[model samples]
Target: MLQARTICATVALAGVVLAAGAVPAAAATAAPARAAVTCPTGWGSGAKSDSDSTATPLSDIRTGRHDCFDRMVVDVPGAASGDLGYSVRYVDRLYQDGSGRHIPVAGGAVLEVRVAAPSYAPETGEPTYPARAGHPLPGVNLTGYRTFRDARFAGSFEGETQVGLGVRARLPFRVLELPGRLVVDVAHTWTAGG
Candidate 1:
């Protein structure tokens, strides 16, 4: 009788343990689901411009790649945020600012970036950002970038500097003016990471 009781106890303990585990497993299966990923909206492909101008000449050009977009930054020394002006728009073709010569860019679409600051120092008339002779910007490589195909310095003339950004297509883009910098970002696609 004692052996039979022990066997019954073991069976009873296993049943209780299984019931407890089943409750927690069911609760875990009923947990809430996660939200889906959504891409940013409202940034368009139209022309973006600001009328503000700065006497501080643009000194440098740089670029970066991100998860959803590619970026280009123009450095303007001694200029405050929102003090610099820019006109960023998709164009059929890119051309030199002063010479009006056609600039051949490599991509399906071209972004004409016009900053309202010279690339030269006004005091000494020396180039702060030197000319590129239609070549890609120094140190900017677009080999693995998702949005950018090529970038060239179009020209700097009459207190304005222009750059040609060759992109994969006419994608949405935005311009941001930070302290002493003008930034342009081109989205990879209509949906983020698509």
Candidate 2:
């Protein structure tokens, strides 16, 4: 009886040890298997449309950086509702919106950006996004971005504006509508694991 009790205790103790060891081993194996950060989907190589219309003209165009992607923002006053639409896609070459002149870009890929709303005043046909002759025009300084090379105004006409984006490589991109602005984000990679 004494030997039987000792054997049973030893078996039970061994089972407990095995259970404890398994918990850590399972955790370790699952560590690398952790779910990676998922980027927003349904943003593909095509025109993304937001039918909601806005008369508010674009006030500014800018770019910022994030861990996963680079951001471009088109600012328009009083556009809190997503009444604006856009067409953002990769292209073989860029052209001036009104003149149809070929634009030379700095990178391997070109992103033609078209905004549905105008960037000018209707009454006097005044310039909202003023252009500089013989200069590169208003563009963001993409000093440290992994994918972005350059961005500039292609042109604006017929109540639409165009901005051309030059990138190191053709990359995944997304667009959004925020208060007073339309945003474009180009991803650093297909999956931003961080």
Backbone clash pairs in model 2 (N, Cα, C under 3 Å; residues 3+ apart or in different chains), count: 2
Off by over 4 Å in 1: 1-38
> Model 1 RMSD to the real structure?
5.8
- Model 2: how far is 91 from its true place, Å? 0.9
User: Which ranges in model 2 have alpha carbons more than 4 Å from their true place?
Assistant: 1-42, 133-139
TM-score of each: 0.79, 0.73
lDDT of 2 by residue, 1-194 (tens): 99999999999999999999999999888866545566665455565666565666787788898777788888888777577878888988988866778877778788888888777875667877775322244766889887788786776687888888887777778888887888998877765452
Candidate 1 structure quality by residue, lDDT tens digits, 1-194: 99999999999999999999999999999999965646665688999999999879998899998766889999998999999999999999998876889999999999999999998988888988866758787788899999999999887888999999999999999899999899999998976633
Best by lDDT: 1
Evaluate all candidate structures by whole-model CA lDDT and list the values in order: 0.89, 0.77
Q: After superposition, how far is residue 125 of candidate 1 from its true place, in Å?
A: 1.3
Q: What is the lDDT of residue 76 in candidate 1?
A: 95
